[model samples]
Target: MSSTRTTETNGAEPTYKRRRTQRSPSPQYKLDDDDTYEPYISVAQRKQAKLAKLTSWGAGSDKDKANKLKEEEEERQDEEREEERRKERARKERTLLMEAQEVHERKAVEDSKKTETEKAEEHDAEILAAIASRRKLASDLELAQGVQYTEPVKTSWRPPRFIRERTSEQHRRLREKYHIIVEGDDIPPPIENFTDMKVPEPLIKFLKSKRITKPTPIQLQGIPTAFAGRDMIGIAFTGSGKTLAFCLPLVMVALEEESKLPFVRGEGPVGVVLCPSRELATQTYENVLQWTASIAKEGKYPQLNTLLCIGGISMNDQSHVMNKGLHIVVATPGRLIDMLEKKRFTFDHCKYLCMDEADRMIDLGFEDDVRNIMSFFKHQRQTLLFSATMPRKIQDFAQLSLVKPILVNVGRAGAANLDVLQVVEYVKQEAKMVYLLECLQKTPPPVIIFSENKNEVDDIQEYLLLKGVEAVAIHGSKTQEERQYAIKSFKSGAKDVMVASSVASKGLDFNDIQHVIIFSMPKEIEDYVHQIGRTGRSGKTGIATTFVNMNTPEQTLLDLKYLLMEAGQKVPPFLTSIEDPRAAQGGSLTGCPVCGGLGHGISNCPKLEDTQRRQMASHRVSDDRGGY
Candidate 1:
């Protein structure tokens, strides 16, 4: 047969076949292969010719390149299929992860909805395990290994016979009656009568002479604590015999030392009393003298001499007294540190350290000075810190300075003295000065007027004097002599009223202060407490009338309101109407836990700020030393 089969097979368009339902038989596909007329030899020659043509094209034409491109296309298609499979697996994995996250979230919500008891039960085992791990960590850690500790001298004296006579139940009743809150180990029992305490007959006699047959709440507890030679922090309202509580013990300790071995010239000052102000220092010095001078005059003991060390006083005079081996030294921080730094005197034999108006001292930037003074102690001393307000700052300071001190709080420290009738009166901002005259008429002579500013104090004094009111003014700006004169005049009833700044409000116990008029409301509730505390002292009732205007800060008003409510006093409509959101969140009653400022809390406590600033400053010093 010829090589050609049909014209249609010669590359004419193949006609489409229809109407055949049966599949093409395998015999028909085999017949087409066998029908070729060309011999096997001819076919082999044709394949060889085609192979040669392809090789020549590879060298000369681009068809060979096209074949290579076709192979690359097939490879790319295979790779794309593999990539699609990978993407599918990844999507499935993501879906599983999302489902797992949803399950965790649902479990967390279920746990959160559980009651605390239920939750505790659920977590009890894990909690115990966590605690055990923490305990293990603590056991494994050795922190502050380089810190040194020098123990103070332990007290050898026991409570006097009177303190022991009362059963623990009777003592508890006495503490409750006096609202005496004590915190420490081994607290001695409080006494009712002066004779209950173990004192020289002279003190009992002095007490009798002064018509002070019984001790005040602070005196009831504080004297016994000091007598036991224990370090103590004494907190009581103003005029609660706090001075006597510390002063009497100081005298007794000095007397004991003076009798055992008489202090020669340049030898002694068995105790030191630190005060924040010159007035307080002088007052304390006089209080010490009150006991010592009486004892010496009665020929009951050796004479105990005390020196007053304050600024604006001649150092020569102080040195003269120091050279005589003083028995007690009452000093302000500046003068005391000055005397110590100058080596003018020493605390060598001093074992009793008393800080009077301690909160005021710490607040007045005297903390560093006080710390330096503590460093001057040669032995384990008995420290007594007395303050009207027992802020956390004072507590922390007492902790740092004293050893295992007893806390004798007559009442909650920041509380208003129930003895004082606190009256909050709303007045116009412009009419406060005029209303002051009416407030003064509420009580007779021996009145105290507290103003916020020094100039205002002077102005108020002048205004009162012009209105034919006998008024004396005192503040920090005044000369010490002037302040002393004003205090003396007020105490002696020579001045009907004393117009003073807050400087005179603390540690000044004037006789029969009938009323306290607050011409301007103080910003801090603690300050207000102290201002009113100057009156209502020594079992006598007095009234505190405060003039509040719209100019006062809302926080201050809120503090006044809470204070009034707490004291069972009447709250003015203005104060009652004022609302603060913080009151809803544990702010109305507790005030600032750190400093006792009712206007703010721990977040914005001024005392906290001061403490942090001081700490930061100290850390800066360490940072400079490259302690990191």
Candidate 2:
């Protein structure tokens, strides 16, 4: 046979072939032959040979057995280690559980011994007792006389006829300038200046030093009324100089009384100023100190004494001050009540009682506490109530607390400041954050962002911080120190934005605030007015931007629209067209048809169940009679 084969190329068809085969070689009986035979071995036989090579009996007999035994020992050791590790883990878990149970049981036992109210009461008692212990009674001689020192009686004198005529002319000018309305017989005329108001020479000099030459409308009216020794309710816009309006009269009266019959130690303060918040009390106290210092110069009125009695400070320190002596006490209702109850001080000699931010005090449910404090005064002291707005509740309170008070409404009650350029933007609730960010970019620094609650305030503050905005927050939950620091930081230009709750709505005087942003509409219209009032103060123009959404209460929106219109600001069509969501959803005043109850519908009525049962019973009785 041919050894080569011919193949077709490309498209050619012819081909030739030759078979190629080789004969098997004969096996050789030699060691070299073993190597050759191994390549030809079957898979099963080859695997058998590999197993034999690896077995102890096949190679290095004793050494292989020793290696196998060593591996077995290692396996046993590893198993023991794993078992030990699992047991240790179980032991640790058990120990932790036991510790937790012990801690829980101890807490449970302690909790069972006393209720939360009892624990709080006990803590309060300890604090009060400590304060009482620190308090020292007045010297026998001082208490017996009931005055610091007796002064010769000076004959009371009235203003000269020319001064009275000038005062009348000034009053007319003030009424026209501030649009002030006064109602009551013998209404005192507003003063032309602090000098005409009969403010002490020292205070007038102090005011001049501070460059406060003119009197704000509230001061012009409120000061004269307060000086006349009549209960007065002064209503003015926030930052319209209400603090000085009431404080000037207070200091004047206290100084005059101090000259005649000074307060002795433990005789209690001659004047008590109640504020709604600790911050307000502190602010008022600082202002009072400034005024007192002006009058309390060396050898001037025997160094008039004042003290701040507020919470979050050591009561013992306050007690020590009270024991030393305090002519004036500025305090919150709760702390003042606590001091009065503990006898750290008395209201027996309290000749003047002023409720600053009286509307807020009443809103916080301090009406009863205020009433209790008033009971201590027995209505003999002059009560001066000052607020930014005059709600009906406030009017009711004034009726009960004041004796025919002269209602001094600076502008319309609960109306926002005319100076503020109010703008309303209709936005979705979810898009408020984005809108706020956009607003901040355009608005200048020294902005105040008012949130509806503390949590929102914190959230907005944190978001601003994340966006590299210099911001601080003030709310009721913050300590007094934190609140003070935040306000100071904002005032010093260290912070640009302040996120606050309604805690900052009353009596906080941020003079240079350029913008007020309402992150959420307040539940009350008065609060909205106050929030915006934070800006446009002290004769400076400001902008107030409010974000309104459908989720906002319909009544709040309506009230806001009315307020905006009253302020002569343009209202958006969306705000005008917004209907109450609840009403649109078929909510009605119809009563339950089954029971005529207002709360529920017929489907869920308890009476319906009984009625159905009775109807079924009647049907069964009718079927039985028909069968008979």
Which model scores highest in TM-score?
A: 1
Off by over 4 Å in 1: 1-157, 160-167, 318-320, 585-589, 606-628
> Which 10-residue span in candidate 2 carries the lowest summed lDDT?
131-140
lDDT scores of the candidates, listed in order: 0.77, 0.73
- In candidate 2, stretches whose alpha carbon ends up further than 4 angstroms from where it belongs are 1-160, 163-174, 318-320, 578-628
Error of 1 at 133 (Å): 26
Q: How many clashing pairs in candidate 1? A: 0
Q: 27-111, model 1: which lDDT tens digit per residue?
A: 4456556766654568558757866886776664577667857866987899999999999998887877797999999999998
State how far residue 528 of model 2 sits from its true place (Å).
0.4
